[model samples]
Target: MRPTILRNIAASVGLLILIAVGYVCFWPVPVEPVSWQAFVPPGYVGPHAANTRLSNINLIEIGDEFGPEHIAIGKDGRLYAAMTSGDILSMDLDGTDQTIFANTGGRVLGFDFDASGRMIAADAMKGLLAIDPDGKVTVLADRVSADDPISYANSVVVTLNGMVYFTQSSTRFDPRKWGGTLDAGILDIIEQSATGRVLAYDPATGNTEVVARGFSFANGLALGSDQQNLFVNETGRYRIWRVDASARNIDVQASSSQARVLLDNVPGYPDNLLRGFDGRIWVGLFRPRNPAADSLSEWPFLRKILLRLPRSLLPTGKPYGHVFAINEDGDVLDDLQDPSGLYPETTGATETADRLFIHSLHARRIGWVPY
Candidate 1:
């Protein structure tokens, strides 16, 4: 306990602190983040108030299956779940009669049934694909530009005439190397590069065309009842865009009338879109917006420094559950929530005759509420 002994110990601690600071400040990161003005989220209040309705729902266990990100009702009237294990699960409404209908060997974020009863998936890793009734998988469109490609192919919807519309969540973060789908999404939103796009793939000609571009993180997609419009979720900016389905190319902010914001300044990050039988479109708010992140949106330096720190220390959205239904005019008709978030990360919902199947990004079991 001499002065020299204490001095040496203090010196060692000082050096360690210096090294840690240097690593955090000078480390190179893959994303070159940009700053954008992020509006403060309207907290859960009034119609969007917190409740336990979703938390008390019945859970259909998927055994070891994790991350049932999306659900679909096939032509056969059975439930199909896109699981994190890279397998599309076919089962009854009660979670029985489970079968691995098809394995895409990649993540299927969203899928829909084509007129021919083929399951079309927007695979984050493999690209757009088609799975036949017999479990045969086929790559439909892996890349539009061999150079830049569809980096993060996300939610998809099939038009009655066989056109497939999907969203590429980001052009900067490729889910393949950016540490999976969720990680890549975080990077894209943090970067705010606005490179996300909407695309159309035609099966007849085997061609793909850009429908709309310049989105921060285009996530989910749903066609309008008329099939002439498409609603897309832009996660990074907390908005949903309406794009002209027939437009071959257009920027969201262009002078053309092809693209417009359907719903701006959402309360949280919108994930997926599902058309309910009630003539309303259900939208999933993946995570409640973080106040700290919004406050730092205009501060590029602060965001970049935070990104350089350990991800665990970074500001992130809360798990407060929220989802709502909106009419074609973007009027919110229903808001359901569970502030306790028993089934966290409610990504989307699939409505049927007797129940509403709640989708989650990382839940072990699928949740359902008697509608």
Candidate 2:
């Protein structure tokens, strides 16, 4: 073969191989089998009679040194928090000097612990990330829409098989535009596409599947104590939906299986959810969907037109902080409001021995709130 011809042939072969590998690496691998449910709970007014308010609430302002999003309290009585700006920090019960434990170079949101005590985070800009005590970072679920680089990791919880059930708060919004679209409320969903769902991330096989879909804005995720179903909080719809992770091997029929809502309108929009040792679910609230926002949500056709404009030209809404205490049955028990109103609403919660730690994405801090 001529020298130039040989070189051209070699280059063509390399390009073909690259294209093949790229296709496999970046494909929307559909859900293996989905459990589907279309039931939504009736709009709730307030806490049910069976649920009671949590008292003796105490707050600790862990300054800008350690900004937090979601919180996790390990077995060692130490609290770990995912910071929105770029790092995860550890703090003591008395709001002591917080220390940076993990630096993922992305906004950290939801997190949970594995059997081995490794810290897993639902990073907003990045996908799922795991951090060991030494601060080693690992990418568990690197992308939601793998081929598209569509990432919006939110809240995460671990199962026995080291699998993770998590949420991607909004598919229409990514970290690049988070600051511009963070609190769009119901209007965003009405204006944009409804792209929210719960996902199953298997570490052993390095696989991620969308187990449930059709949510307004999926935010928090948690497994029932019995492990019967994985619950996801759809912020825009103002409800929580349950998915049957066990049915993945069975069937993917429309009516065969369903992801049902546990509770809706717990007096405020639920941001992140956690099941406590006592059977109650601790949820972080970004804020109640401003009724005005909800009213505006009904006009998506018009809002959709506005979103196409430059972000700087849009009217960004205000931000605030809120928390909710709900029981195992999905009933709101008490409302945790920000009396000080210094920082924006919270994302996750952690319980340290006698204290409760919270992550404030809008405020730069990491610390505890008296339970």
Candidate 3:
């Protein structure tokens, strides 16, 4: 009787093990990872060397709202910030008399002011939007056609010619269906399908055209001082690209003179690009590079397995505050680092004469440091 009982127990243990193995091997996941070579992360050295520069940030409380993803000073000189709550709040530079400017009802990751004082916004879930000065919201371009819609509209810049250029972070992963921008972005990066593209919309003609295509995860955009080149942050590959604004439907993957990598092998995931005063472009490193994620880039199967594991076990971006400024020549001009990451998800900086307003993706308060 004892021998029979022990055999039954052993069989039960073996069955449990088999079930676990099967789950790990074939369980469906949202991301279908693609194999790609990851660049070796350059440890915080050179211009990005570890420092306490961003450690002392002054906070401006926004009470209950969080994730000030992008901030732009309007023509009226009031600071406009796109919050996570879908409310664009306008306030004084010192954070006084804050009031709701407009609510797009969709997340606006980045925005720019047009020549006519309209706020051109890149809405992640709703596509490109235009908010007039009187707090009226309008959809500029949601889809090129019924079959081909903008999946994830990201950053925007309106040229002097009334041409609106924005980025579609991924054509494969829709943010609304995948549970917001960050989650969808992670899935797209893991998949590495490189469906991100740069598009231009002519406000006069109400037409949209592709300026450039083929990026792993395009995050940010900043028109150059000359307004001829568009600086794009390709987040998945940790690099910044300088693409010609005039190039139509240029594939960045192919050997094209229309586009070139500006900053390569960044130490962290680049988030937003803000052109500052005097030809300086500020870039926010959302999170420091994860060595484990980089290692799994070449092992697509392992990445899939990793995703199948518990969310706690999956490799994720560590909270580290890092932002820097670069010139058009790809030279690092200023670097700020906060290893403690207390200020959280520094998306980028908006530079003024006296202060540098830091943007974040998950902070209740806006941070700023003396310029």
Candidate 4:
């Protein structure tokens, strides 16, 4: 009925599309996408097949204290959990006598007990922390160097000698500003900046130094029983690495002989490492790898374009409970799974004498299954 009007409308729409395309293509995002070689993840099968063993876990409700990402048994023979509310919860084995042990005012994704009965935590906002029995919290190490500080402090391990080793999940995304740990992790993974690193803190010397660098997202750290090596989870690459405990000022990925890949092509984003009853290392696969994300990994331009879009529109992986027991040599002993995702985002599992306590990043309660 109106050809001229229809032409004008069409031109306007075309111009808008052009502008949108240009913005997406040339956006100056913080991430400088790296062209990484990502392989297709293995389907849930064989030793790592799907199961519902962790489906009907007994939950210890934390009320509003949510997101218990890591758990450890304290010297008092009680359960202690690091929660999203920046509080460490202590309770009996049956979830009784619940008490707020201490609040770090920072998110603690992982923690371990030192020989002195102090709980050493790797906090996302405050860096390494030590909480004594009297609820006293001390900031151990917040920065590696003035230029390259620890941005995303993650999982930590304390040796019997009191040396602390921890992971910096991302140097680019600070969890305090970029949202929580998950949000910051998404940005780091999408950017592929390889800024993740590992560091060591000597309590006696009051010094901190970088142990390794050049990981996409170094997520977790676990010291071997021999105390000679450290197992680290590289969440962005779906691999677990073994770094020499004595490694000093080395880049585990770029140059260096002290570190080696212990496990490769893992089924999902390896989240944390926990020492089991018999030197078995328990690892939680936070979520299965996203097919779309992997497919775009080789194409840095596509990743950049993806980053330009709203994070809500991005293809993120759905939650599925999965954990595996492994040895120091990367040998998988067993896999526990809940394919239906009854309990989502199983980050790691702490094995006690009688039960297994599961950690989560989203669930409102801590899950436990009989050992």
Best by lDDT: 3
If candidate 1 were superposed on the true structure by all CA atoms, what would the RMSD be? 1.7
| Per-residue alpha-carbon lDDT of candidate 1 for residues 1-371, written as tens digits (9 for 90 to 100) | 89999999999999999988887777777777787887768887766766666767888888899898999899998999999989999999888999999999999999999998999999999889999999999999988867758878999999999999999888888889988999999988888888999989999999888998989999989999999999999999999988899987687755768888888888888999999987889999898888899998888667777877878977777677778889888888888888887788999989898888999999998899998
Question: Where is model 1 poorest over a 10-residue stretch in terms of lDDT?
Answer: 46-55
Model 2: residues with Cα > 4 Å off, grouped in runs: 1-45, 48-63, 144-150, 177-192, 247-256, 305-321
Better of 1 and 3 by lDDT: 3
TM-score of model 4 vs. true structure: 0.97
Top of the candidates by TM-score = 3
- lDDT, residue 14, model 3: 97
State model 3's lDDT: 0.93
Lowest lDDT sum, 10 consecutive residues, model 3, at: 308-317
State how far residue 55 of model 1 sits from its true place (Å). Answer: 2.3
User: What TM-score do all the candidates reach, one by one?
Assistant: 0.95, 0.75, 0.98, 0.97
Model 4, runs deviating above 4 Å: none
Model 3: runs farther than 4 Å from truth? Answer: none
lDDT of 4 by residue, 91-194 (tens): 99999999999999989988888887899889999999899998899998888767766778999998888888999998889998887888889889988888
Q: TM-score for candidate 3, please give it.
A: 0.98
In model 1, how large is the Cα lDDT of residue 153? Answer: 90
The Cα local distance difference test for each model comes to 0.88, 0.64, 0.93, 0.88
Q: Could you give candidate 3's per-residue lDDT for residues 100-177 as a string of tens digits?
A: 999999899999999989999999989999999999999999987778899799999999988999999999999899
Candidate 2 structure, TM-score to reference:
0.75
- Using TM-score as the measure, name the better of candidate 1 and candidate 3: 3
